[model samples]
Target chain A: MARERKFSLNEVFQHTKQLLLEHGYEGFTFGLLAERLGVSRTAIYKHFENKEEVITAYMVDEMEQVFAKFVHIHDYPTFDEQFRFLLNLILYHDDLHRMIAIGRRIPDTTPAVRANKERLEQFHERMYEELNQLVERGKQEGRIKPHLPNRIVLAYIFQSVVVPHFPGISLDQWAESIKEIIMYGVMTGN
Target chain B: MARERKFSLNEVFQHTKQLLLEHGYEGFTFGLLAERLGVSRTAIYKHFENKEEVITAYMVDEMEQVFAKFVHIHDYPTFDEQFRFLLNLILYHDDLHRMIAIGRRIPDTTPAVRANKERLEQFHERMYEELNQLVERGKQEGRIKPHLPNRIVLAYIFQSVVVPHFPGISLDQWAESIKEIIMYGVMTGN
Candidate 1:
């Protein structure tokens, strides 16, 4: 028999993230995961009951890391700086966007999936609250348009990260262009 | 033996689109498709060699429809009106976005897939050309910011369609909010 390797929750989460990104939710399987981890399928079963449980645990862990970043927004002085930080965070963590898409498609059948969904909702609420605060501050500072609803601004900022990367443009160029478009309207002078 | 129902190319295209949207590319299969259409597997085989061929054909047809809409841009008076029409078309055809996502994941293994990819690229090129014209006109007319690059503006317009729909907000509200942000921006003063 092959020697059984020890694995921590962090190891499991990292591998899960990689698997999810590589194959998406549909292709993710315990057998593939165990093979990748150099362990028996029973080893994985010891950690989670099913694929849904593994995915839910991984998502919950990822959300906590994202929440931590949101909590640190208070350290930034200007709304623009805060906004930039948030944008960079989203752009760098491309996996989060893919995960969100996959998560939406996963059927919420098990109790673990339902609980994870609730936790995900809570994370979203917290993120939105922080975003609202940033927008309100931007309005007060005259950095953001006061006329636009907070929700609209919130959605605009969130959507900026997912802008399709044009074939010819470099990543740095794409990031700068998106940031500028979000900050200033594409319209010319008044 | 039961009498076979005759189906047109258009019928196959339409039903294939419905299947791709409902089950995604992975779940889509000739067996399911034939059953859904109340036809035998061999009937579908007569039209398509495999799922890839069906998808490519469906995509080509859909792109032609989209391109036809692009061709009518000259009928609109203002760039803003033209922009709204494009946005509305994309927003209402939610399947287009989903199909694009699913299409990207489909492996290209055959001549049909390659040909379809080329046609899709051509459609994109045409769309981008039209978008560039609109952006240039918007700038000349003092509607769009003169400093922003055409590519940036193009990305912004395309990205607007995929903005996450905020919970509790009506579709009209979401549409209006996105339009305002893209035009006036979230910033308060010029």
Candidate 2:
């Protein structure tokens, strides 16, 4: 009888990702990975040329997801819903340590850092366009202030939640506070 | 007569700051730094233990200036002036890359990365307190609208600037646009 194949390649890649998320760059050394997998390092070699290649593949995949999310973020039904999504990313975002490691794994600050900053940067336009559209829609529907510039409003909401602006707060608190401000600003201007 | 000292340690450290600001963190290596000082690596070592120690000192010193400026930020006599100082950091805050590096520099996610996360997270509060005081004062003076909580205002002003919700813009432009939003929120109801 032919020898049975052990684990599928996707399974191997998933295992590698767990090791990376748990171990970080140093933790994901080839020896340790093979030991973790109970397979020869050569088995890993069959799938990946080296450790960097494996990790880089994982990172590229993650970057692709971040970009795809950027495109699909506007699919949420309402501006409030969109703001909620942003808040989820900002206050909690990933395990900051894990995400930071992901950042370090990339090379170069100017060009993609390992994947693509330009693509990531342009992702904002989609967000802005949707935000502007929402605000215009809100104005028409009498849900938002007529005076608010959709672009500026969108920028404000996006900036606060994504970057480290407030310290020692959870995403829930961050979202609640932003919604509060926007609520007050657009209300009562008579 | 005793031979004159070539250059003081303080002088060397000062020049290192100038270089780091000009070249950025990736390009700011010890070899280049030593070359700039016209000294050997050994001589540089005599004064400092390593590159990180140098960087920590420079960054901490920069943070000190920022902190001091915030203390006096409210002394600017008007909301517009105080807002100007706030925007200065967001819009023209040079060395953010280095700041990010110092806070998020660990290559792999590990205990060291955890340690860095705490350090970076703490840095956020340094500015929050300053903004909080201003918001409290703004509300008491009735210059800021009473409907919004100071904490909420402080949080919104900060979060919106860093991770911007939109794409296709420079951080500076995003910050500038958000600055307007903050000002608009406090404006005499139009």
> Cα deviation of B32 in candidate 1 (Å)?
3.7
Off by over 4 Å in 1: A1-8, A40-42, A137-143, A166-170, B1-15, B40-43, B77-85, B136-143, B166-168
Residue pairs in candidate 1 whose N, alpha carbon or C atoms collide under 3 angstroms: A144-B188, A145-B186, A145-B187, A145-B188, A186-B145, A187-B144, A187-B145, A188-B144, A188-B145
Best by DockQ: 1
RMSD of each: 3.5, 7.3
Give me the runs in candidate 2 sitting further than 4 Å from their true place: A1-46, A50-52, A63-158, A163-170, A179-190, B1-29, B35-38, B78-80, B94-131, B142-176, B184-190
Worst 10 residues of 2 chain A by lDDT: A109-118
TM-score of chain B of each: 0.82, 0.56
For each candidate, report its DockQ versus the true two-chain complex: 0.58, 0.23
